[model samples]
Every structure is written in C-alpha cells, then in structure tokens.
Target chain A: MLVTCLPDVAKDVGANRILKTRAGHFHHPFGDPSRPEASERRWRLEATKKALEVLTEPVTEPTVFEY
Target chain B: MPTNKKIRVVHYVNQFFAGVGGEEKGDHPLTFREGPVGPGLLLQRLLGAEGEVAGTLFCGDNAYAADPGAEAAALDHIERLAPDLLVAGPAFNAGRYGLACARLCLAVKAGGKTAAVTGMYPENPGVSACRRQVHIVPTGDTAGGMGEALPKIVRLGLKLARGEELGPAQEEGYLPRGVRYNAFAEVPAAQRAVDMVLKKVRGEPFTSEFTFLGFDRVAPPAPLKGLKGKKIAVVTEAGMVPPGNPDRIPGSRASTHHWNKYSFGGRTELPKGSFICIHGGFNTVFVNEDPDRMLALDALKQLEREGVFEKLHEEFLSTCGNGGPVHVMKQVGQAMAKEARAAGVEGVVLPAT
Candidate 1:
C-alpha cells in the first residue's frame, strides 16, 4: 500500500493501489506533530480508515482512497 | 614507484568484527582504535607497503539504529582521523551490518573522501541505499567469504584512493548503482540494438548496455463487498510496536527476517500510552501521542463495533520501512502475505511511511 503525500511515488513504485492521506509521508501531516484540535484529528483518522474501501474496489488501474 | 607515500586508509566495521559479541552486543556504541582491528588486519596484510591501515572505526548495529546522533558521531571521528581512503564491511548477508557499512561509506564520501563497502548480495539494502555515493563490491552470502571479499575490497579501495579511472560495474566486479555515463562506443547504438534483437530472435546470449529495474505489478484484488463479516488486518512498515519493543526490532533498516507481529486480541481500543512509534524515519512525538495517526487502531476498533467487518486480525504486522533494503522488505511482505492468507484475512490496510 502507498502512503505517500506525492501521487507520483505511487506511480513510480508500481503500487497498483494507492492511498493519499492529508498527512506528510514522514512524521505528522505537514510535519506538525502538535496535536491538532479534536476535529482535525478525527478528520485524519477517518481519512486513514478509508483505506478499507480502497481494498474492496475493483480497478485495472491505480486508484486513490477518498474518504 | 620510487616515492614512499603509502595510502592512509580508515576501515569501518560493526561491533561483531571489533571482537565484540554478535547480536547480543549490537547495542554497543561507536568506538575507534589506533589501527586495523579484526578484519582490518586482513585488509592491512593485503595493502602491504602501498597502503597503511590508519584507523578503524566501529559501531554496534543496534546502537547505530537506536541513537539518532550515531551518524554525526561517526562522521566526526572519521573526519578527525582524516584518512586518504575509507573502507567498510565485507558485511556478507548481515542486513543491519551491511546497511551500516553502506551508510558509513556514504558519510565518508560526503566528507570528500573515497569510500568502498563490500557485501554478499547485489540486492543488499545497503547497496541500494548508498550505491550512488560509494563503490560496493559484491561478495558471498556469509562471512566465510571474507578471504575472497577482502582482497577485492582492498583492490577497489586502492584504486579509488589513487584517483584511478574506474570502469563500469560489470568490469569492476561491483554492483551497478543504476548510473550511466556517455562514452564513445565501438559500435553505434542502432547497430547494437539490431544485433541484440537478432541474437534474441536466434535465442543466443546477448547483453544490453542499459540496465533497467522492473517492479512487479500486482493488480488490486476485487474490493471486498459488504465488510460486515470479512476478516481484515492492519499492516505497517511504520515501526509501531509495544512500548520498549520487546521483539528488539531495529527502528530502521530492520534486519532480514525481523518483522514483528503485535497481538491486538481482546482489545477494543489501543491505549496511546501502551504503544510507541519506533520508526527512525520520522518524528515520533505525534504518533506517540496518537497511535491512530499511524495505525488507525482506534478507528479500526470503532468500525469493528459498528460491524464494518467481522473481526480485526488478532495480529498486526510491523517492520521499519525507512530506508530498508529492497529484498528484505520484499521477503517481509511475501512472508506476511502467506501468513495473512492462511489466516483467512480478506483485506489488509498497509500503513506505510
């Protein structure tokens, strides 16, 4: 599974399936480790949970995880 | 040949070759000695009068991974020693050790000194990590090949130290770093391609001057329909493990065959305090504050309660993905895939960093 902030990483790494998250590829999203407000954290969490949907979709090409 | 200026060489090795214990002593910190210790002696003998083993620097495999400052510390020592050439590892198949050697070579090169490392496989993670920065000679899979590997490493080190023009990897017996140079060839490219195609058509041996790396294309399986009763799992290369990481998994560049499985059974939610991020690739403060950032464990548990899936797999697979060797990462994925399939896991959420 791809967890890159850059879409091209998924394309280059040959990951047939990809998950684009709001968070940075390394450390916290945008490199901000300070806990965001509860709502922001929830948004990030929900976005991550959407990975399950990516697994079930049938696609011949690369697809993104949209929550 | 009349002038008597011997090449001063600095050698690097893991704690194991420094006469320290094996994996048990991998936590030993960086240290330096006056001259050739352990394998350095072999290198010294081979250098004869032409080169001198100026110094030997060593570090523990696990220590290097655990300490964030290890690289800077090592660079400091090497810079102070200021040898003409730096040599690292005939590390064989030891994944962590091989990677350390490669990184050291890269560090040495960054300081404007030529460095070389040797290891067993062309695919060793260290080779891929620092190939662009250093020359890596291929060796056998075990330390038993030291006799053969050392001479080759010495030969390459001497050449690099002398600023001699080196040939391509194939001719030099080193792993190719996927770099190319423009040079006048004996034949034109169009003619070479035609000859190559002709040879291929005739089923004869042929060689391509350009080397391209191909990755496996795995089509996504049909998405799970109705998540209510399907078994799902969370896998990560983000290096999240139980507090203190009982498995002793290195934070980054996880050694070959060192993936850890954490039990998630009987827990509806993971306590933030109970888990920590050990991945050396990123800042861990936020992940430690909220494990869900990396694992989405809380969300997965909530989904389970909401009947999004039948059951979360009792175990979560984890390994450090940061700068890990390609082959070792492939092996980990393959081994885990087989295990997940056997466990009847229909879907996996791989959180990568």
Candidate 2:
C-alpha cells in the first residue's frame, strides 16, 4: 500500500497523555494529559510521531535493516 | 630432490553402488576392497595423479538409521584409511545415501583427516546436518553436476592439503566449511592489532573478516521456588512502562531504563476496565485483564501477603515482548533487574513464552 507523507497530519494526531481514566472513546489509543503518568505518555507520542515521519517518504522506501 | 611423495585419498560410499549389495547392501559392515572402480575411484581422480584410493569402506543407510550401534561401529572404517583427503558422495539426492555420506564425512573429519564431502540435492539432509560440522561442497540437485562437483571438492581439498589460505565460501563457490579460526600475519600480528586500535581510537571503525556469531548466553535466574511464598516481583515482555514508556524504549530492542514503581493493596487495584495495554509485541491485555489470575502474581501474592509468608516483596517489572531479539532482550532484563535490585527485592519471576 502506498502511504502519503504530510507533516501536518502527524502534528494533528499529536501527543497522548498518560494516567488516563476509561472516560470515553475520545481518550482512545490515547489518554488524558492531566494524569500523573503524563511524562511517559508524552514520550510515547513523540516516539510514535518520529517513527511515522521516518516510515513515510515521498519517493523511496525507508531503510529497513539496522546493524 | 625427492618428488615421489603421494598423498593418500580415502573414499566412502553407500552400500547400493559399493558392489557389496543393493538396497539390502546397507547392512554390509565396514569392509575394505582395495580397488580403482566404484564411487571411490571418481574421487581418487580429483586427488591428483600423486593421489591413490588407499581404501574403500561400505555401510548401509538402513543399518545406520535404524541402529546407532552400527553407525558407531562404521567409524573404524574411515579411521583405518587415515587418508590425507576424504571424499563422500555426490549421493544424487538419495536420502539414506545422503545420510551415509554425511556420517562418514563427519567421522573422517573428527579423526583429523581433511574431509571434503560432495552431494547433489534437494534432500541431502546430511549436507545440512553436517554442514556446520564439515564442508559439504555445493552441487546440483541432480547427479549430472558430478563432473563439476567432485572436481571442485578435490581442488579445495588439495588447497587445504598444501596449507594454502582459503578465501570466503561464496567467492570460491564452495560450501561454508564452518571452520573457525584466528589469523596472525607477518607485518607482525601485534603491530597490526596496534594499528587497528589506533584507528579505532581516532573514532574509526574497522571490520574484522570474522565476527563472533552472538553471545546468546542468559544465566537462568536462581530458582525462585525457595521464595515460593513471597510476592515474587514478576515481569513479562508485556510493555510495562511508567504509563507510556517515557524513556521511549524502542517497541522492540528497547534501551535499558529505570523501572517505574506502583504500590497496590486496598485502593491500588489494577482493576478491569482501568488498564489498557500498549505493548506492540503480544496481546498482554489477556493477562492484564485479570492481572490477579496469572498464577505467579496471584498465587504468590496469596501465599506471601495473605497467609503464606511475611509482607509480599516489592513492585513488579515489565517490558514489551514482541520482536525482541537477543540483544534487546538482554538490555530489557538488565533494566528490570536494576530496578528490582534497588527495591531490595530478593527474587524475580518471569513469564515464559
């Protein structure tokens, strides 16, 4: 499948917070920013964002093998 | 100058064509008929004009496969030849034949003769089984490759006999002989090593032609059965982090990090509907759903905290499991163990896949 790269799309799907309550579907594969565990949650979101940026390129595929 | 030295070549073959017998030939014990015909003669030619087929040994595949006793006895046949170069098969994709060739080649090699084996095939189980054990020259899946096959084996065999340096396997189109070694050469190995170290000291990385396979050693945790009553702080590849892995541990080969602690009792229940799993490896949710259900944690907690022992040990540990290969697994364990030790925990229990 072809994937499109857009900087704004990643920004929109942005950071998730930790220590969330099972409040609603809105706090999905994401959580609320107010919890005590927010630091871990934000770190995860940033990492995911970086990974997505790496995977989606305009022309070629990303290098898959690592030493 | 004395140029009359001839290196002896030993040939091994299966019973069918050895002329001792046919399908029933596999029972023909190790008997030597000094001759220049049979499969052994083909190998003798490759050993050079100076080489002689000093011995021929025969054994049946059925006998070897069916009885370990017979296979063990067959080792004597190759040992008797004491050849400089040993050759076994272009077995032509035959199953029992392939195994016989493999077994004989291994025996010859173990006896310290330079053994070179050849085989054709899709089902040369012996080629693969003995591959890491000996050099099974690559050949066609059919016997037609014999002309090209045995010649290559002989060339390589002679090279080793002459004590010539061998190159990489694919470059020479030979099988990976799986011989491991260290190299020392005349610029002086010590000087060359110092040169390498100097380059590395200057922030340069050089490649070594040979690399150690991998250090997959994991010393088993001391048996926790003695602490069977303690709340043995348990862990898994379940992606357990401080809520969201602030350390940004790679979902796979995660870096080592400090463990986040959680205290549980009256108010601290990891209740259903309260926890969600972020582990990308396996569906840890199944266990987390009823954390108290997984035996080590629940049963141990019951024994230690409730009635079995004193206060159940401290916090639990965890990490994502999916796709964690050797290196990553080690790093994660190091991190988890560090935290567990800091908490004064006596022992740890880990989930097995």
Q: Compute the TM-score of each model's chain A versus the native chain A and list the values.
A: 0.63, 0.31
Quote the lDDT for B297 in model 2: 36
For residues B1-353, could you state the per-residue lDDT of candidate 2 as single tens digits? 12345767666677766776778566666556675447566777666686788776666778767777665665665566666666677676787778877877776677765645555463466665576676666777766777878787777766655556777765665665555656565687677778888988998987554533333322233333433333345554545444445655455654555234444443233444333345565445553553432213334444454443444455556565556654445666667777777766654434322
Index of the highest-TM-score prediction: 1
RMSD of each: 13.9, 15.5
Q: How far does residue B175 in candidate 2 sit from its true spot (Å)?
A: 2.1
For candidate 1, lDDT tens digit of each residue in A1-67? 5554555656665666677775544564322244455665566556655676676667787766533
Q: Which portions of model 2 show Cα errors greater than 4 Å? A: A1-67, B1-5, B177-353
Give interface RMSD for all predictions.
3.0, 19.5
Off by over 4 Å in 1: A1-67, B1-4, B214-353
Fraction of native A-B contacts kept, per candidate: 0.49, 0.00
- lDDT (tens digit, per residue) of candidate 1 on B1-353: 22256888888889999998888889898988998999999999999998999898888998887785787788888778777788888788888887888777777787675555555566566766776667888888878889999888888778877777789888887777778988999988899999999999999999889876445566667767867798998888878888888888888787767787888756765657667888887778877876766776777777788887788898898888778766677788888898889989988877776
- CAPRI category for model 2: incorrect
Residue B283 lDDT, candidate 2, scale 0-100? 48
Please give the lDDT score for candidate 2. Answer: 0.52
Model 1, residue B208: displacement in angstroms? 0.5
